[model samples]
Target: MNTTSLPKPNSMEFDIHAKLKAANSHWSYCYAVHPHDKGFDYQFNTTFVGEMEFAVYERIENYFVLVDFFKSYDEACDDAKKIIDDHPDIKKMFSVS
Candidate 1:
């Protein structure tokens, strides 16, 4: 009798292109209140070519005080919050539920 060992399956690799496509396909907007700035910011995830992209915009009065683009929404939000929190004059802003 001969016994054969089953080959182990390789861990799934993250497909950057596929993920970017999916993220763009399901593109939706979300935002988090800045812990120190009473300003509104917009965030969205998109795909460019075959790479993931993220964007954030903060409007102050009638001008955009902050405009940022990132590789992921999570990173964009994190950076935006840090900026808002660092300003002592700004207060965290939130939307009404």
Candidate 2:
């Protein structure tokens, strides 16, 4: 038998990390949260390579902003859905499936 210790993730941290991992499967990207923003800001890149990369950001309070360089809106949507599916708790947050 093998046992591995995975660090326990807080609710918000788990949601964000899970979402980002799901997004990465479809879009070659990286996601991170800004500590100073109190989880209000998230950053993601839509490309595997650096030079042609694009970032997408969402501000928890105000709006969801699309930063365009490449990639389709549909892809982003699908990625978002995958994230929700990967973590059911997120659906519970809005009381929907």
Candidate 3:
């Protein structure tokens, strides 16, 4: 019996891009905090689902790459600040520029 295969994702793709855009637009305002280094940054934002998340990014060249995620904003920021206060060169190690 010859069987037909399902269409590829891009062949008849749903409005996935639009959906993602809408979802991303609904997220709360983001706060960029913890001035680590020239090439390292930290930010925290709440999602549309009301979940809070913090992100750590490291810059390679012209763009930044996500390094890690944390759960609490206050906790993460406090911990990061403490680390920076204790060791100013911690974030500099991850910096590219």
Q: Candidates' lDDT values, in order?
A: 0.40, 0.39, 0.37
Order the candidate numbers by TM-score, best to worst: 1, 3, 2
Q: Over the full model, what C-alpha lDDT does candidate 1 score relative to the true structure?
A: 0.40
Highest lDDT model number: 1
Worst 10 residues of 1 by lDDT: 1-10
Which ranking of candidates, highest lDDT first?
1, 2, 3
> Candidate 3: which stretches are off by over 4 Å?
1-48, 73-97
* Count of clashing residue pairs in every prediction: 6, 0, 0
Better of 1 and 3 by TM-score: 1
Q: 1-97, model 2: which lDDT tens digit per residue? A: 1122223334533343454444442332333434565745544444544223334555545444433222332323434544444556543543424
TM per candidate: 0.30, 0.23, 0.29
Q: Which stretches of candidate 1 lie over 4 Å from their true place?
A: 1-47, 73-77, 81-97
Q: Tens digit of lDDT per residue, candidate 1, span 1-97?
A: 1122212224654333343344443332324455454554443234565554444445555443334444432333444546645653432232124
Candidate 2 Cα deviation (angstroms), residue 29: 14
lDDT of 3 at 61: 52
Instruction: Name model 2 segments beyond 4 Å from true.
Output: 1-32, 36-76, 94-97
- Name the better of 1 and 2 by TM-score: 1
